[model samples]
Structure formats: structure tokens, C-alpha cells
Target: MKVEQNADLPKTTHCNKSRRNLTEEEKEARRIRRVLANRESARQTIRRRQ
Candidate 1:
């Protein structure tokens, strides 16, 4: 008898298709802006403490 390993398991169709959907550039831009804002806030805090 042959044994099937975990790696041979079948994947769901949804899993294969879902990854095709990606975030838009506008959404990415917004995310970057939020990160920069947080960094700037942290810098201000350190400067104020000094």
C-alpha cells in the first residue's frame, strides 16, 4: 500500500484564487503615509525628552 504525505494534500480552489486579489496603489500609499506619521511622532517624542 502507498502512503500519501501531508505535502501531497490537495489545496482548496478558493485558496488558489483569493491571492489574485491585491490592494490598489492608493491603499498602499495611504498605508505608507500612516507609517511615516507614526515615525515622525516617535522622533518628536525623543527630541522633547532630550
Candidate 2:
């Protein structure tokens, strides 16, 4: 039996523009979002466990 290889697969993408650093406000917003997501996840877990 013979196996075929994918030659057109890309190893990495070439991003022309580098990512910029997030400011303090953006960081705070991200933190708030994370907290809310975690809270909802915990609620769902508790409901499932009950």
C-alpha cells in the first residue's frame, strides 16, 4: 500500500502587520469579559451537577 502526503499545507501564516499592545482600558474590559464568562460557566456546571 502507498500513502499520499499533503504538499500544499501551510506551516504558518505570514502576517504583514504585527499585533499592537492592548491599553489599560482594553485589558480591564477583557478581564471583565473573562469574569462574566467564568461565572456563566460555573452556573452551568452547577446546574448540570444538580
Candidate 3:
């Protein structure tokens, strides 16, 4: 079986056909959720650049 990049994210992220069905609000919400979920990773990445 093929696994996805992020275990925390939904499988829909890898399916463009399904993604196209999402409303704008849903897309925005999904982006927000992804950002929220990656807060610690984002902080670490920023810190590494310093």
C-alpha cells in the first residue's frame, strides 16, 4: 500500500480530482488546519534559518 507524506493530513490532499470538488471555504479551512497542525514544525524551520 502507498502511504502519504503527512499522517496527520487527510488522504484527499493527494487526490486532485477530489480536491477540485471542495468549495473555496473548505479549501481555506483545510489550509488553516494544515498550518495549525504544523505550528511546531514551522517554528523549527524558522529557527533553523536563523
What TM-score would each prediction reach against the true structure?
Answer: 0.50, 0.61, 0.42
Please provide, for model 2 over 1-50, each residue's C-alpha lDDT reduced to its tens digit, 9 standing for 90 to 100: 11123222332356344756657896776666666666666777898999
**Winning candidate number (lDDT):** 3
User: At residue 43, what lDDT does model 2 achieve?
Assistant: 76
Q: What's the TM for model 3?
A: 0.42
How well is each residue in 1-50 modelled by candidate 3, as lDDT tens digits?
22233635666756766445768897787787666657767676898999
Residue 38 deviation, candidate 2, in Å? 0.5
lDDT of each: 0.55, 0.57, 0.65
> What are the clashing pairs of model 3?
none
Clash totals for all models, in order? 0, 0, 0
What would the TM-score be for candidate 2 when compared with the true structure? 0.61
Comparison by lDDT, 2 against 3, better one: 3
Q: Which stretches of candidate 1 lie over 4 Å from their true place?
A: 1-23
RMSD of 3: 7.1
